[model samples]
Target: MARTTDGNPERLAYNDRVDRLRRKEYRMLKGTTYLDHAGTTLPATSLVTQFSHSLQTLLLANPHSASASAPNTSHRIVEETRLKVLKLFNASPEHFDIVFVANATAGIKLVLEAFSGHDEGFDYYYHRNAHTSLVGVREHAASSHCFASDAEVEQWLQDEHSFSGDANTDRPTLFAYPAQSNMNGRRLPLSWPAALRSTSQRLRTYSLLDVAALVSTSPLDLSDHAAAPDFTVMSFYKMFGFPNLGALIVRKSAAHVFDQRRYFGGGTTEMITCIGTQWVAKKEKRLTDRLEDGTGATHSILALHCAIDVHDMLYGGFSEISKHTGWLAKTLYERLASLKHANGRPVCQIYKDPAATYGDALTQGATVTFNISSSDGAWISSWKVGQLASSKNIHIRTGSLCNPAGMACALGLSSSDVQRAYASGFRCGQEADIREGIPFGMVRASFGAMSTLEDVSIFAKFVQDHFVGKGLLNVDDNDEKRVKSEEMRRSEQSSTPSFEKPGLRLRPVRQQFWAKFGACIPFRSRRPDVVSAH
Candidate 1:
């Protein structure tokens, strides 16, 4: 709930502590400042170490025989990881089934395929801002509807006239929604899910939550909410661990309803035979194996386990992490407001109410978005900011970030306009040329368990200074070298070449060389290797 004051040395000192920790935690580039935890987080040392150990063990074992020697070890690691995930979500082991998949998209597909095949004629509902994977399923489903708001959902359920009577008319419905959006970092109301559950019970429908972003932060009482929904999906990568893995938690009573067509061949089947013989499916009660149709990413799973363990220990558990992230978000929102451009305009246009407490705004999680304003010639596109941050050794992501629906809804921009803006290299609404007006995407600054208060202040100062052209915190000679090299290339291209062999032959060899090395040279480089030397 606390606010950060600009030029407050106490807050700046706190930010410095976070920066130091980040340098240690991520081995970031010197002078680089990372402010983009929402897209992904740097892996903790524990996670990296554990991941390496698992990989080494797998590599050491002989081909086609690793499982034989390390069967129990592999299973133990997976079970332990699952238990960690269970603890994070506060779900019981018996009711929750954890099946590791490639990613959130894969998990969504598996669930959609299973639920859609039932021929129950159950209506599928989702928000307009639902993830693409869920959106695709909704589009494909025979009976599906998307609601713009909570009121729309209420109206749809009340109107029996909208429903076509069928044998499974009383069957439960499926609702898909994200806990936090990747685009704007907007946290959807938790009350919405509970309300959906209540509506589902009265109307004999079911709700399935896509809690991919919320798994690391949001607190849900599974016991009380279990009956309302048949399943929930979560992703491991978004929480600062391994990539390419997700899980689906299904209730015990509704487990039988899922029809399994193995997407891949391995571990999912109990037995197999050829020549008109049959393969025995894995036990129904063992729901994890039901959906885990392929060989597991044992190493990545181990990393995920390590991440969760380290997350609990260092961040004072998920609850404390959530609190820390909220504080950081609040600090960022407040500080960014004080940033001014060279024209004496606020650099950031924050959308949320300034008076709102961190707890009020971040009840769902710590994700916030705002527009960045810059001078005419001194532009910093979101993409450019991401690139600049990366050049400074910071890791951040920018752009619509695969959430066109949310961008459209929040900014009132069409999909084509958003695409064009990115293609044209504009960062926000204020940055775009009015004559060539285009809808610009919002810049998101997200925080997580590993984020410190210092990260917020450093990033805030960077934005403020960058807009005013007072020299960014981490700009180096390399940037000037790049500009100079570009100028040289343009000059060379514009000047006519001296042709000894006069067939008007284009200088292919020279052109190729220039093209390759043109961007590599720094603008102020005394020698080409000088830039690389640093």
Candidate 2:
């Protein structure tokens, strides 16, 4: 782990070192491709070991009271970890404060409950492609609206600026959106937050950016408060690959809205007493202290510090991670898009932003969602593909993936179509629904910092051999060969150098990747009858 003259580590010299660490540090990599990084990542060995050792040796007392020595020490650790979280986002202590929550869902709920006025009407706008947690915030707002596309959002913003009404202009408006879509891996425009404020000074505007997906493969900068979201939420595990904790980051400029909260909790109360027939209460003046109720996840918060250290060591920070995973995703996307049947029809139907590219970290991440089809243009069951993937130890995700609106919109399914399918006994996890030829789900393959070109190649070859070549006129002999252990070892070694190489191009990796594991295809039978409708 030494550095060269220019302060950059010589990647080639440490190739053997990384190889040894890969085998020992990441236990989850053994016998698995682990393409479900969007859902959750395998915890690092160092993180787990250090956390366990600390728990065994240290006295981690509750930070609720200051009457004892243990509690004081716990309080110190909690405060220090809070600063680290803020530093990770490039946020300053003067303008930003962090509140620990159960997860990203809890963070969103805290904002909606604290900001939304029940008596005074306010408009809540969010993208239709948002996660279920973001969509659920509509219930707390006075009025809710969903924008189908980015153009629709732009038109609504323009209309808000043109309207000439004193009453409507005075009411507050909150616009929440995802930095990247968990369903399709499409990155949205970051300039929308500033645009909302520029629409009108009369409109009390605020932005809530959901960075759950964006933080998994990229960074979210809050150094420039003018361009950053007024409130941002993300889960710590999404960034560190361990601990199930989340935080809500609030800008001091917009912290006043939290004063509207009606209730107080244990640590949030500064003074509470009853006088005669009435009760008097005073809340903590700090924004985080006022919002965080009950006791925080003390151990998880401490582990977050270690997770950050391990994250920095493994990927060298978000910029390096973005470059590494983006190339892997782009390579996977292009290869999957290029697969064709004997009749020259595309075998995969991918959903993504048209403007996104592999080199553009702002537009895309290491996630790909698509469906496989046969030569006669018949769709294959995504559930079936997922089951096949499990047999090959290739982990992936299927179904709507917790974003119903985005899933339905991506497949071009109408409201009536969804209702009809629902009435016919088709549910989210029902395997029989796939046989009915209903567009119920899609297959997703997500990459991360630990992902290599071999993982991408195996997934591509799986689709080509089992789904595409299974229904073709001619099949290669390699399609019938069983993947031997020695060949797998060769594939692993040939693709190992890319892990330490920064700014690695996709073409060279693909060339060397396919050279070793490209011919290793899944088993296929003779011409099988196509399942067209189902």
Candidate 3:
């Protein structure tokens, strides 16, 4: 990888190199157009090969072993991987502790469980645009609220006393928001967490930054730990495309709070008695030792370690990948936003923040979510778009994308309307695509390090050929059938030449995100983590 220069030719050359990398490491993507990076990045060939090689060579045992003779190889890999992760975010080990988990949702659950141990029950304030996982935390809070607008959050930041009454001053407060909207690829204010932490609030406040979306394409700089969020959660698979791992990056200053969590598992305990005495001791010496419940995912952790190296080698870190994907997204956005039916009606409804998300490198990542409209001005179901996409060998995400608040806000659907949806039997993953002429979901295509301009073009063409002016008349293809190999792809291409036109112009509509709160939530109280008397 050569130094990135501010020249078009260099960028083109870099993109060519990426194409070559795709040819070598991502042959699995040969016959298909993969646009579902948000669901999971396509695993690279070298990642699997290297991971297998490492497993064959290393004798990694469980991190905790009763036998003194067994080596702590697993522990070593976990710690090294932690340090590498810290460095990835410009965080210092001294300032932050990494706790590996199954995935991002698992990390959020860990935080909620830890916060539940507070003596005075924690107060949870979330932005309305948070993911469904973040929404679950309110179930454990003493009180919960959703901030519907930035004005509401600004008001809270300016006057924390406005939120916390004198009677509830001692309760710990957890403010959670996603760094980017998983639903619409809307990059939110990275400045909010720092703002929340520095506020003059009577309650003990902590910020939970969900970077599961942001870290996939952009860098999260924690160089100034004090200015960073208190707890950051992410899935390693989002960035590395392998190992299906996640981490909770806890500010070391806030490390004591998690120690209070009441639950303790096998490896988390230093000592415990089940037969004779009612006593237990937790391994509180190190952060990882205290939090990871069972035997750690040793093999996955090794793959995670390899993934870090592989990503750097393949894409030259997230900075370069950011620019690469951003350009593609912007190009796609412009084209999609320009699409129109023959009757002069717009063909797509794109949900985004035009000022903040599009081309604002600091505020946006590479994701686009939109819904198509028929030539007759009727809304097309995202489910139809998704089905057509699959039949055309284009992989995309459809539906609400697990952001209920964002979906409600985007569609202007009230609580009663949501209830009506349920009344109409609109269950998750069901064919409740549209009801009463209202759409329930939008199509989403996220770009990754390996995603090229061709992927975006193919998706745009798919939308144009099947949608635009033609309604459901072109549904003759084998639904969900794939051209598995290059030979099959060539045979299909030679047999049926695509008459698909290439164009996309998603209707530009601004939307705010990364905040979800309710007026008054009757939150529950859970047992707090055990506090140390020493």
**TM-score pick, better of 1 and 2:** 2
Model 1 agreement with the true structure over 1-534: per-residue lDDT tens digits? 143555557545655555565666666434655556665566766667766776776532221245575666777778888888776767787676677877777778877767666645456777655766666776545566656654565565565334332324655566777766665445665555456445433444555677776655545557644443566777777776555577787776667656534343666666667568765656454777666766677767777777777655545555555655666776777677655645565555553422224555354357666555454323244544544444444555555555545545554454455455546553332222221432244567777656766566567755654455443223457764553454356447766653323322222112100000001111121111111100
**TM-scores of the candidates in the order shown:** 0.73, 0.83, 0.87
Candidate 2 worst ten-residue window by lDDT: 511-520
* Number of the top lDDT candidate: 3
lDDT of 2 by residue, 18-50 (tens): 446557788778888889888876678988888
Model 3 Cα lDDT, one tens digit per residue, 113-179: 8889988888888887788899989888988877776667789888876555432667888889999
TM-score of 1: 0.73
**How many steric overlaps are in each model, in order?**
9, 1, 26
Question: How are the candidates ranked when ordered by TM-score, highest leading?
Answer: 3, 2, 1
Better of 1 and 3 by TM-score: 3
For residue 284, give model 3's deviation from the true position in Å.
1.9
Measured over all alpha carbons after superposition, the RMSD of each candidate to the real structure, in angstroms, is 11.1, 11.5, 10.3
